[model samples]
Target: MLQDARSVASRSSQEAEIAGPASPEFIDFDRLLAAVRRQWRLVAVLGLIGLLLGIAYVMTAVPRYTASSNLLIDQGSNRIVDELSTSGGSIEDESGILSQVELLKSDQIGNKVIDALHLTSDESFMHSSVSLLRRVKLAVVSVVDISSWFRAPEEEADDEAEKRLTALALLGNDLDVARVGRSYVLSISYTSPDPVMAARVAQAFANAYLADQLDSKYEATRRASSWLQQRIDELRQKSLETDLAVQRFRAEKGLIAADGRLVSDQQLTELNSQLTLAQADVATARAKMDRIQSLLESGDTNSVVNDALASTVINELRTKYLDAAKRQAEISNRLGNDHAQAVRLRAEMENYKQLMFSELGRIAESYRSDLQVAQAREAAVQRSVADATSVSAGANETQVQLRELEREAETYRNLYQTFLQRYQEAVQQQSFPITEARVITDAQVPTAPSKPRKPLVLAISLFIGLAAGSALGAFREFRDRFFRTGDQVREELGLAYLGSVPHVKDKALAIPTQKAGTGTEASDRYLRANNAVARYVLDHPLSSFAETLRSAKIAADLAISHQKKIIGVISVLPSEGKSMISANLAELIASHGSSAILIDGDIRNPGLTRAVARHATAGLLEAVMDERPLKDCILVDPETKLALVPAVVKHRVPHTADLLSSVNMTTLLDEASNAFDYVVLDLPPLGPVVDVRAIAPRIDAFIFVVEWGKTARRVVRSTLAANPQIAEKTLGVILNKVDTEKMKLYRDFGSDEYYTSRYSSYYHQGK
Candidate 1:
């Protein structure tokens, strides 16, 4: 049951080792900071280079000055003539102002300024300056004609048009036009090498714009006047022709007009008046005749009332008849029949009645004659009016034509007069000069150049440099694949990190020791003289470096189950200080009055044998192969009383793997296990040979040594991966040659705890 449990535990340990540690959380900021810190030197160098480049640009760049001129465009001002200026006032939108802006930027204004200032002939405005670098580039381009590979090459010929275009482009580049806020003011700026030229060009632009505006207005007025004059002359001739046509029509049709009345119209008016008078006369005469006839028919002379009644003859006749009737009536009453006087009176009364009848007949006959005459006149006058109306009707057509001609003449005359007045007004306006814009402020020579802002350029340069440096630093940090701290060793290799050994100032004197005797004194003197890093536990046990090794010793003791634990110190590659770890660990154990021995297992190299060379004549090779006693090969340090089996020999043994696994080597280990409390072997690096693999099963445990921030994690992992049998026996990992100051940059696994500022006081130089 116990065996099964042990097998299960072993499997669990292998699984845990293979699984490695959990992946660390991805803290981008921490990682970025660490990467920057790792390559801060490179960043600094690049930043310095950028600063120099900025300085050089500031020193070499050309200076330019800008001068501006302001103009007030009176958009709200009244025009010369309200009627002639048919163009509407400024709109509520920006279109009118924008159009003015475009006008200022147009080639017309630009060319005027250019000509006035003689800028077309000036080299500063027309020609571009070529730098040395540009000249070199041109030379190279002329020498090599590789452009043909991409397209058909053509000749670069210069012409008059090209020259004008180049000059125009240069002029445009130097000129700038902008509207000043929401006002009617426009700002015109010009840049040049000379401050005087800049100011002169700006002022010239404003003057040219004003002159052009005035000329435009004058030309418009002149054209309008010319057109109006032509139209007025034509209207005058039309008016004359219409008047002459009216007079000619009147003469041809024999129609005359007076006071707006025609000759035919007068004739019609006279005929109508005569006809009315004749009808009135006829009616009066007919009324008188009818009254007279009525009186005669009735035979009632006394009842008749007329103007004829007032006539003397008619009145006398009527009076006589009435007297005779009265006398006859009186006689008839007095005398009976056959009276002579009565008969005679009746005869006289009859005679009187007859006379009265005759007189009324006479008056009636006279009225009837007058009526006949008046009727005759009325008939004649009616015939005459009819005839006159016929003649007037004929003349009416000609009169209508004459009236139409008169109307046309009148209309032409009115139009002619209006055009003539308008033409005079246009002529007067043509002499008046006006402009839409005026200069508000004239440009002056500037005192300082506007370009080459030193501080801004330097600041930009510094920012660009820092960005580039940071990018490069990040790239370098990503490219490096080495372990930097104990956390990296534990996380990547899946091995327990025992401790870190801080890099001491002195190599050999890091361990403090008191002189024991001559022999020990001589060895110390040799170690101190040769400058080797060895035997720290026997010298200064209180030192951090010595304490770290002591911790490794304790780790090994706790890990190994064997009573006499055989611990082997091994590394993935060379130069990892495995031999140093072995020496220190053994010395640390022996310092506690424990029987400990260090073996030189690396026959090929024998680093420990060389470190203590005086007593390393006969080593483990002789003990294992030459049938010599193990005690004969044992070398003891007199001060620490540490036993060592060195590998110093005349020639290195071949097939070192076979030799380490031989029976003699095993018997020697077993015997040493019985005599010593701990056995430390300084084995060859696991990468270069199979010696460590051959000797791994014989040892109780293995101590893996890694160079801090130097050994790649893949190398250490691959070394153990290839030899799984030895990996299972690994006690823990030791990170040596740690830069305590640099280790503060890493925060994972609490790596800074052992190397922080508070721990610096615990580290001291061994006395």
Candidate 2:
């Protein structure tokens, strides 16, 4: 159990280190709700103030009437003049519509409206009523103008020009022009104090915009026409000059032509065709002549060469030769030996064959003649082709310059035609002027004013006020760093929370002196008058304050299993009522039939001695220094039998911490432990002194006291951390001097303090 308590203490120290002081790692909504409940009055008052201001503004503000006119940027209307006009005729896209919107808001349109309405001369339009917000702004500016005292004299100005400029500026300021969504429709709005004037101004702005568009288009078309006319005249002159140059160059170069082609070119084409035919004829003739010659050389007289020649004499001789050969063969068969008739027939066949050869030679000679004629024709045609080629080549060289001149003439002619057409279109467009913008809805007078929306303004003001109040409340909550309840003590120090002691007022701290009484009664009255808060536990044993001391006593008993326990009661800082708690706790324990001794161990500043035993001359300091008997220096209450060893400060003791840590102090506590059932020591605080740390080893357990809503959580955590032995030995923490009324504000739903009201009747206080 002791090890577990130590571990919890160690873990709590680690958490304190990690979270620092008031770290906002996690938000506790319950705490926030409690804070809101506590500070709701502040938030409500701020919001009410904001609401009143908003109401005053609404009541005093000037109302402005707004009139609207709608314009449709007709992109389709441009199609009527799109083909004829050279200028842009229609709004193309969103950007074009926005451009038109900007044009409507331009100073040119504003000037036109001002002139049309004669706004410069009209007092209502020239000097409208100023708004409350504007008045406040002007007042602030005048007050803050530091240069007004040293400013130089103003120069004379032109009134009329200034009025005109001011009117234009006012018109621009009150005008609102915007394109409606993705469409080519513009909404123009004007605001003024007068309804009729507002409508008139809005309508005038629309008229001015339309007129501007028409005038711009007309001017553009007129300029285009003039430019096109000038270009047409220049192009006509250029066209004539180029045409003349082409004719002069053609004639000078002698590039004569028949039809579309030159004469020399035609002649070359004809000669080339003739050369091709002549070459073909030559090939045919040579082939025939070669065929006949081959037949004659092979001696094949009876071959088809002779037949192909179609000679009557050669055919007759061939027939007669065949008959003779047939007759010779028959005669040789009849006459066995060399027959004379067969020999004679053979000689006749030979003669016929020779005649056929002679005929074939004649045919071959005719073929050779035909071949020579074809060769000569081919040669003549080739020579003519060569001559034509040379002539055509020269004509072609001259045609290059002719082609260049023709191209130049063609270009001028085409340009002249194009300019003439465009000139006609420009003229048409100039005569028929049209604008892409037109009014779709005329401006109408508004029934109500558009300024000073009361409900919305009030709501916004209230919201802002509430937000600011909430911020301030949260800051206050963050700045509240002191402990207010037992939960805070347990969570911050990792010690068990014993209980809370109710705050005792100064009147309650002083007991009324009783009129003369018995010896026992007189002694009790003296003790009570001297320290009523410490003696309060005896009179009100069942009260919450006394119950808290009992709880501490129980915790001390649980922490130390020894029969005699030396428990130290310590606090982080001085004046936290630890001395009173120590005295009360010892008295409460002694009243329970236990022998308890109360010792004022704070030798440096003996607050307990001053409150309880101020008349004592010797104390723990005297006993430790001079080895005095504990009984001689101790003061015992006659009623409760509680003993107290107060430190009597006769002089300044510089080494009180050393004296507390000395062997004599240890021996004194051991001797007291042997006599008393409980040894409670009222030690000095841990913040400004090290006496508690010096004697912490001798203490078996400690009860830490923290003044409610006074001692900082950081101070307690740091003091315990500086003295780990005290933190380890601490049995629990007791909250002293708690304001019970304010304590309810810090309690969450399930905490013990939340149920304090329900259990209040359980304890009674003696008056």
Candidate 3:
């Protein structure tokens, strides 16, 4: 009971929020668990699909082989030659030790291997020999033939040799390289079906590199020798030309040859003597010219005459000195003899006069001597000077020529020496046993080829397959709209359910039966024998949906008799237990042994007959039209003591809606209530038909039966408003088809999650 109350309260609270087809809107883990439980079969099927894909992947995939070479790339190898030095060249190293492995992988080395192994093919080998389509074919074909072909052959081999060559080339491609650690040893591995081919390919790599190193050394030697010979010839020519120039100069000058067959020591010594003499002459000339110019600049006013002028040159010189002394004396007389500047100037003037007189004496003597010497001797001296000048000019020209020859010769000599040394070194290196970088490890041929993981592909396909299947199942679950849960009936309609009639999967449901007559009340009796058999559903006052149902029913029964004689049946949609309402009410009332007659007034789709079985006829139609008398038209159920009027018609006319709502229907309603204890009318939904409006005022009160979540209160309210006075006689709502299990849940909780917030408040307050 507590559990049912909690469920009702929870549904009521949830209905306040989203207003859904109310069970408890709160989907607890249990309900979710239930939904998942239902889908477990689907999950299992999908899982099986996933497993199949995984298996398929494992079965159909191509086996992939990876051949890796382990190499110890010595990090310290770079430092190996930092301490080594050549005469003038730097250490020829590219990270010395580690780069050895890289060189093995170099195109130069690899190309050598390719050439030695003859791996390059003309056209077909360039593109992938096996691809996705080809692989699929191979996979399919491989199923039948074990040794068909590793890869499809492009052109059929013409001969055995060609076939073997092609096979070898195909197997050669499975080669790879890598550094293992900081070790110096490298392990090279190649992948191929033939183990011999793998080892051969690795050995081919080492041989190719060794051959390249030897070729490099030989080429280097050849180049060096060629360059050196050319340089030696050029230098020899220059040396000869320099020697020839010296010889030619000596020959042209008629100079004595040196003891060494070029120029003599005596000739050189003589040239040096002449050079000194010439230099002395130039110095003397320069000195005289400078003195003459200095004299001119000093403005020496005193001059001395020569002996030929019949003058005492010395006396003239002395007179000038005397004049200078007189001038000095006059200045001294005026300014005093002790005056420093005047004294100094007088002394300087006297010294200048003495120097002039001395120089005059020397010049007079020189002039006499010049006159005495011959004019022929002067001419001869000029000739000697001219000859010396010509020789000096010739010598300077030779010096410039010598300089040019020397510079050219020096340049060639240096280059010749360099090339000679380089050539010598190359010859030396070639003579010795030079060790070149060699591959230590051969490539290991891989046994398996890598690609086309079939198991993984199949696994993915299976996953997709299962997803497709489960989605289909879920879609069916969503499309079914029968009142799936008892809570849905109660909450959506603002009504509560009395009970659920569990699905009795009886085969009898399929048996077609003639529509029962008014005497068919026996079925109802079997259905409801005890209150326990009735599945009494009590509403909780704490539940909002129950409150809504409570409000709607109280409003519907505002003007009712003690027994609530007037009953207004409504449903959220058509055929939602409204007919059930009429039947059950009659059954309940009749059980009290109070006279009750059920009216089948739903002119359209009259299903009251289906529920009561006694009224599935045109008796109600006959009575309204005055075709049948009340006593004859009325039906009395044998088992339930409930009377049913049947409108069992031969042909159902369209105007039955109008006839049931006519004044005659009202008169019939008043008269039937007087005759029987209670008259229950099974009207069509207020939405579908309007027969109730005409008959409602005569009713004392009404009872609305709503399947738990199947009916909406707003619909009931609107239908009630159509006959406002009768609507007031509503005796409250009865929730039909309530699930006992679900009812217990909300009843214990007493609200949905939204309203459950107050739980803490109340719980804390209680604490």
Candidate 4:
């Protein structure tokens, strides 16, 4: 049976460890909701404060009005001077629009606006109404000007210049310029306390921007015209000087030109053409002469002699010779040889051949004459070509310098014409300057203030306040290491949770004072009810405090089946109501007609002795050290018949642990066990002393009492873990001094405590 009880206790501990504290990996929504419920008051209070602050801000804040003006940067507006405009009368791209926006925001435009409006002298523009917050800030800065003391003095600026700069800076601060997305339009806005002033400032900004643009363009054109004039004069002078230099160079080098070409070059070209023709003529005449001479030398006169020298005469002579030869042959055939007529015919043929030869020789002589004339002409042309070549070569060498001078002169002349044209354009542009930017929509006074939005400010303030409150609440929850519910006792210490005991004050349980005439029985009753907490179980048996003790009794009975179970009431820290629990539990057990005894085991402090047996001088100490009988040291309860062996301390007892662990102490408990059905010992807390550990082995079971929301959970777990024997013998834990109403907020939906209110009527409280 003892082994079975031990096994059951061990299994309960193992289950408690398995169902220990919730893992950090997952969020427990029930716990979070419970925390929120507990901290709702704090959150509400902070949110209310934030709402009040927002109301104050809305009431005290200065109203600011914003007026806006729209200006269009027309790309074609400058087309009146398009021929002279350097920007080509067109905005190039997005960058150009952005540049215009920047220009509108520049100090140049800002100063112009300031000067035009005379903001430096206008009191409304120079000094606006300050808000309450700003006043407070200025006051703080004046009070905490520690750096000013250490700063070195500097020279002051001119009054006029300083005023101008200050006005410019103020204008810049109030001015807002932006390009209307992807378009050549600028939006200029100004904020001020006065609506009229805002409109005026906005209009001033637009006017100033347009005026500045016009002034910039006029200045650029004027400077360009002046520079062009100077450049034109220099170019004209240079043109005249270069022209003179070209003429002088040409005369010095004798480079005379004709029809856009040099005279020497033309002469060389004509001589080359004549030389080529003369060579061709010489070749033709030489070929004709050589052909006729070769024909004559070959001596073939009877063959058709075609010569340049009168071919008709040669043809006539040949015909005649042929006729004569025919006659000579006829006669020679008719008459005999040696006839005079036949001989005369043969002589005529000879005469015709000689005349053909003579004619051929004369033709060859004429060919030779033509050849000589062609050769002479070729020679004469060759000489003329050589002379022309010499002249052309000299001219080419001098032309290098001449060409350079010509090029310089041409460059100067071109520059002079170009500058003159540009000067004319610049003059035109200067005469008619135009600005591309113009106000399309003039600024109007705003009907309502633009800042200090009350609703939005209130909402944001509330949100921030709530967020802050939640952060603090979460920090409080994180630091809440104390036990609130019975579940905490079980989960943290791995022990069964019996129940919770209410914190019953003595005034609430008001015990009547004993009269002088009252008997011994009445006095004993008064003494028994002296401590309301210790005697609560007897007076109110139906209360939750009494019920918790009953549950502890049942747990003790189940854990230890001995005839006289020795149950030790223990706590991790002092003042956790362990003595009260021990006294009440013994009284509750004895009220059922079972004999029980309470022992004050804390020899060092002996709180139980002071509570119940205050008049007793000697009790457990006398029983253990003086060897007195336990019955003589015992005090019996008047109502429940519960016995108590109080530890009466006359002086400091240094070896309280040794006395508790001595054989005499064990014998004293043994005697109590034989005489009573149960022995309840109010042992010292496990944290402060070692008395509980020394007497743990002798005890049958222990009922751990923890102060509700007072004792740290880690202290209990660590104390129990340090003494495994005491932990194993522990029957269960009881949460003492619980605030039942507050505990309701900490309960989960499915927990036993969640339904505690439903069954609370079953338990009645006695005054």
Residue by residue across 1-767, what tens digits does model 3's lDDT show? 22332333244345556754437666576555554555667766876877776777677654554444343333333221211113321224435544665666666666666567655552333234344674575468558765545546755445654534433444344555544554455565554434445566666765665677557555655665576677678777876777677667655655443464323334445555655655565555445444444544554544323342355665665666777787778888899988886788788786866566556556545554444443344455556556655665666566566557657667766766765666566556544323334454445666555444465566677777677667765674465343434344444433334333321122423322323444545343222221221111111123332333334333333333254354556553575666655665565566556787877777667666544343244467777786466766665655456777755556667776578667777677767877887677777666765656566656554555555445555566556556555434444355555553444333322333224345423322010
| lDDT score for residue 584 of model 4 | 87
Per-candidate Cα lDDT values, in order, are: 0.76, 0.82, 0.53, 0.82
- Order the candidates by TM-score, highest first — what do you get? 2, 4, 1, 3
lDDT per residue for candidate 4 within 161-256, as digits (tens), equals: 767765776676667888877777889999889999999989988998888878778887887778778888899999999999989988888888
Error of 2 at 362 (Å): 22
Candidate 4: misplaced stretches above 4 Å? 1-27, 71-110, 135-154, 158-187, 211-438, 512-526
Better of 1 and 3 by lDDT: 1
Those runs of model 1 whose alpha carbons end farther than 4 Å from true positions after fitting are 1-49, 67-121, 124-129, 133-191, 198-446, 505-529, 652-654, 747-755, 759-763
Residue 21's lDDT in candidate 1:
65
lDDT string, candidate 2, 1-767, tens digits? 45644644354446556867764648787777779887788888888888888888899878889999999987666543455455645568777778888888888888888889888899977767444555575568668977765666574346987788667767777889987888888999998989999999999999999899788778777777787788889999999999999889878877778898878888899999999999999999989888888888998865766345577888788889899988888998998428888888889989999988888888888989999999999999999999889988888888888888899999999989988987777776677688887899999999999877878989988998888788888787888899887667768777777889999875755563423436753443233336678778887888999888888887766667667889899998899999989988988999999998999988878888887777676778779999999887787776777888888889999998999999999999999999999999999899998888888888888888999888889988988888887888887788899998788888887677879999989888863
Per-candidate TM equals 0.56, 0.67, 0.40, 0.66
For residues 439-473, what per-residue lDDT tens digits would candidate 1 score against the true structure? Answer: 99999999998877889888888778887998887
Model 3 misplaced regions, further than 4 Å: 1-28, 56-483, 486-493, 509-561, 568-585, 592-594, 608-617, 655-660, 677-767
